[model samples]
Target: MSASHVVYVLSCADDSLYTGYTTDLERRVAEHNAGEGAKYTRGRTPVAVVHSESHESRSAALSREYEIKQLSRARKLELVGGE
Candidate 1:
């Protein structure tokens, strides 16, 4: 079986939300916490994966990530089960 792609939401240290797609969720989260991930998340260290969804393709995961990023903060929070 092939690796699944993931769309994820992170709760940042500054109380902000971040969305991204990756095939290796654990490694990506570790990179974010280690200050080696996306530039937007670099300074927002100590991020926690508040939400995540798996997809069969990279394209699907990336599209979903974009959709999540476009949602309002309130909606995004709701998507994360209000966490």
Candidate 2:
């Protein structure tokens, strides 16, 4: 897993989905919970990883993150097995 990057979906406090790329998934999650991560997540504290996808490279993870971000909420929920 260390050979690749990761794209994760976070379930926020207000029940919103947040997608992002990270090299260290555990640390990133901790950062988000600490409110020291993305500005979007700062207000959405107590975020949790509902899903994570692996990519071969940082660029690949980033591209996937963009794709996931563009997905509709319903689609995103489907991706995370919420529907």
Candidate 3:
């Protein structure tokens, strides 16, 4: 069996949002919090998992991550269960 892939949203220290896909949700979020993740998030540490959705494959997870990234802040908040 294979582990699930997930598309996740993180709330940055400045209250902005970052979206990405990963196989290990917990570890990825920890990396962001540790300032070892994406460049945009490194300066805004202490990111927390605001939302996540599991997918069947890496491709599907990436697709969803792209979709979320293209959304407006208002729409993203709606998808993440509101502000």
Q: Which candidate do you rate higher for lDDT, 2 or 3? A: 2
Q: Per-residue CA lDDT of candidate 2, range 1-83, in tens?
A: 45469999999999999999888999999999998999999998899999999888888889999999999999999999997
List model 3 lDDT by residue over 7-82, tens digit each: 9999889989999999999999888888889999999988888899999999989999999999999999998887
User: Which stretch of 10 consecutive residues in model 1 shows the poorest summed lDDT?
Assistant: 1-10
lDDT of 1 by residue, 1-83 (tens): 66489999999999999998988999999999999999999998899999999998888888889899899999998999994
Per-candidate total of colliding backbone pairs: 0, 0, 0
Where model 2 places Cα greater than 4 Å from the true spot, the runs are none
TM-score of 2: 0.94
Highest-lDDT candidate = 2
Candidate 3 structure lDDT? 0.91
